[model samples]
Target chain A: MIPASFDYVRATSLSHAIGLLQDDPDGNKLVAGGHTLIPTLKLRLASPALLIDISGIDELRGIEVADCIRIGALTTHAELLASKPLREVLPIFHQAADMIADPQVRNRGTIGGSLANADPAADWPAVVIALKGELELAGPTRRRRIAARDFFVDIMTTALEPGEVLVAIHMPRPNRGAKFRYRKIRHPASGYAVVGVAATLCLRDDIVSEVMIAITGATSRAFAADSASTHLIGKPLSTENIAMAASLTGEQAECLSDHYASADYRKHLVKTEVSRALASLNGA
Target chain B: MTDHTEELHVVTVDVNGVRRTASVEARKLLVHLLRDDLGLTGTHVGCDTSQCGACTVDIDGQAVKSCTVLAVMTSGSSITTIEGLARGGGALHPVQAAFHEHHALQCGFCTPGMIMSVRQMLGQNPNPTESEIRHGLAGNICRCTGYNNIVRAVQSLASEAPRHD
Candidate 1:
């Protein structure tokens, strides 16, 4: 399907993209990787007057590890899966990236684009929210940070303002004794998560010191299961405790229902997926 | 609904090691550019929607669905279609030879994409297990062969003498 014709300009720099978006009276869209925007354009879901191509912008293209792991917005899923630093530091990213679509899609999809697109079933939101990551946003004048938990406003919506661009994602270095896992029941056709759960656990002397559980695909937006995560704190990683925590996965969530899966089925999947992820962590 | 002829973009891309330049609408997909404009019809468009990997091609050393990528997005990228897999037009690439030997394709509609995907996979991992090959080929689907022989074709290449370019 051909998208509606639109003027395209390749941005020369980060500021250039922001300037182009700010100056366009008819509204402009930024495309990196074009995995999400191009599809939306083809379906006529979006028709911006101008497309600011930021895929070639050097400022949005690398993975750097300082105090926190900073991933450029344009980092592709394939690149994330292949990073030796990410594998050593945050293997949960690998678990999620490997489950995202296939190699061809991964080669062209960008983390920033995925997060900004904010698909309800996207894997990055669950993982990022579970890890308590932060996103850096740039605009025509200023820059600021938004926590992953606050980033997603609703399905296909984000906290980004007009003329703002997501520059990078910052994830804190994993705490010592940190163990994390992401589990999903993927749609057979699109490879999107039917019900995805990301769990991050910290154990001190066999007792849970810190725990965070985030669920996706079950709700309109991916969010941390606060009540369920709180239930794991100061408890041993026992089957009974895990079961109790998993049961609370969708207690506060407004689960989504569609032709693919019913709300009841998604809720059931939340429990099952959380239990499975916790079990994998327990076995590890 | 207004006329958008002004949105035409002049894209210069190196396809199969040869430079090809054309003026296309900014919304034209890479697959259409390769097949319609360049006349390199070896890259088939099974599904225009990026779901089927039939339009798989190597763009700057990565295998991507051409249907999902705009031709303007690859202004200076070096793309390799299935036609570029052979050397000197004489000997087939090991992947092609293996597919031919193992009868990997049945109807041959998905051959070009399958071959392109396998070449990229082998370029990354010269030796891959059966499970790895299956995972690598997940993007490319073939309804006829049931993937039994396709997996064998990739495995055969992995077991052969590593080809150095």
Candidate 2:
């Protein structure tokens, strides 16, 4: 379980991290929280020459609620759970944060690290994709923003380019009368989601003004259930319509099958979890 | 390939209210640094993959899996292991006393982590319900005792008036 030895350098600042990554052409990896990277390293699945510890970078820490909720990349899950502003403004983040692993793991797991790690079963992806969050990235040359929908490319893979570091996560303010929920069937041993669903609904005068349903742990990566969301929009929030929408989840995606659960079972779970999420929102 | 062992990083950490500095490899986990280097073996390493909470320790007042944290990453932070729970090495901490009184632990492999986790839980919510205690201890697993006495132990502590400090 011992990891491969590598050089460790704590980045003093955001730009310094990018500069170190640029200077080290021998696979320099940015580590935050080390919840995901350390395990991978111990497994010897990856052996980088240098590890850039961005956990110490003060600029990459804290939650700022302005026009949007700007969450620094190094903000831990414990911080997210404890944020009073997040709990009042966007309770869904707290809901998801509460279910992420347990207290010990959550104390060290970072939102940016989770998003960048892109674990198929990670809870943040479903919530971020459903909330339409944006990821801010900084590189040696310039900085750019990537939508959550496009940030996760595949399992444990993201659109982060070489020498690029994820700086923050930007989430638009939830619309008025917006109700959100995240429901998941977690694996008993690891606490990872066997199937997770996050739903955001904007209801106006009892009619669904907007809806977004993101499904995770059932496909290669977390993705918006377009068919489900489209079906629920402009329709009255009813059990029948919610059931219809829930059935549409994972319709277009290639559901994953493994020792944890079968593809058919996971697809079934997607429908069940989506229905439960929608039902909870409807009841709210 | 370079000889990675030749590269050692000096880390200064405050463990159990004591400041200690050590030279460790870049890949040295915090659990190994505490047990192997600082001689604080109370933090047991059950599952190094961060699944089991036997390696849990308080890092900067937060419970974290030490096996998943590199020693170099926690160089400047304060860490509290199971050894730090008692004052003046006299009596067990309140949580530890509760566990002992309730017979919460059968085999002691997971006791250090369980005690540390409960200490944190009680710190946050001095009076937690039975369900809350179960949820709080989800990260720490115990093969023996079946968690009945463990829940009772935490419940007994909660039944007492909330104690601050």
Query: Model 1: residues >4 Å from true position, as ranges?
Result: A24-26, B1-3, B160-165
lDDT of 2 by residue, A1-284 (tens): 89888988998889989999988745788999988899999999888889999988987889998779989999999899989988888898899988888899888899999988899999999998999999999988999999999998899889998888989999999887899999899898878899999999999888999999898888889999999888888999899998899787757657899987999989889888888999999859
lDDT tens digits, residue span B2-25, model 2: 446448899999988899999999
lDDT of candidate 1 over A1-284, digit per residue (tens): 88987889999999999999988634689999898889889998888788899998888999987679999999999999999888888898899999999999999999999998899999999999999999999998899999999999899989998889999999999897799999999999889999999999988888889999998888989999998878889989999988888888756678899999999889988988888999888848
Interface RMSD of 2: 1.8
- Scored on chain A only, each candidate's TM-score is 0.97, 0.97
Q: Write the per-residue lDDT of candidate 1 for residues B28-73, one digit (tens) a residue.
A: 9999999999998999999777787999999999999999998999
Report, for every candidate in turn, its global Cα lDDT versus the true structure.
0.90, 0.89
Per-residue lDDT for A9 in model 2?
A: 91
lDDT, candidate 1, at B14 = 92
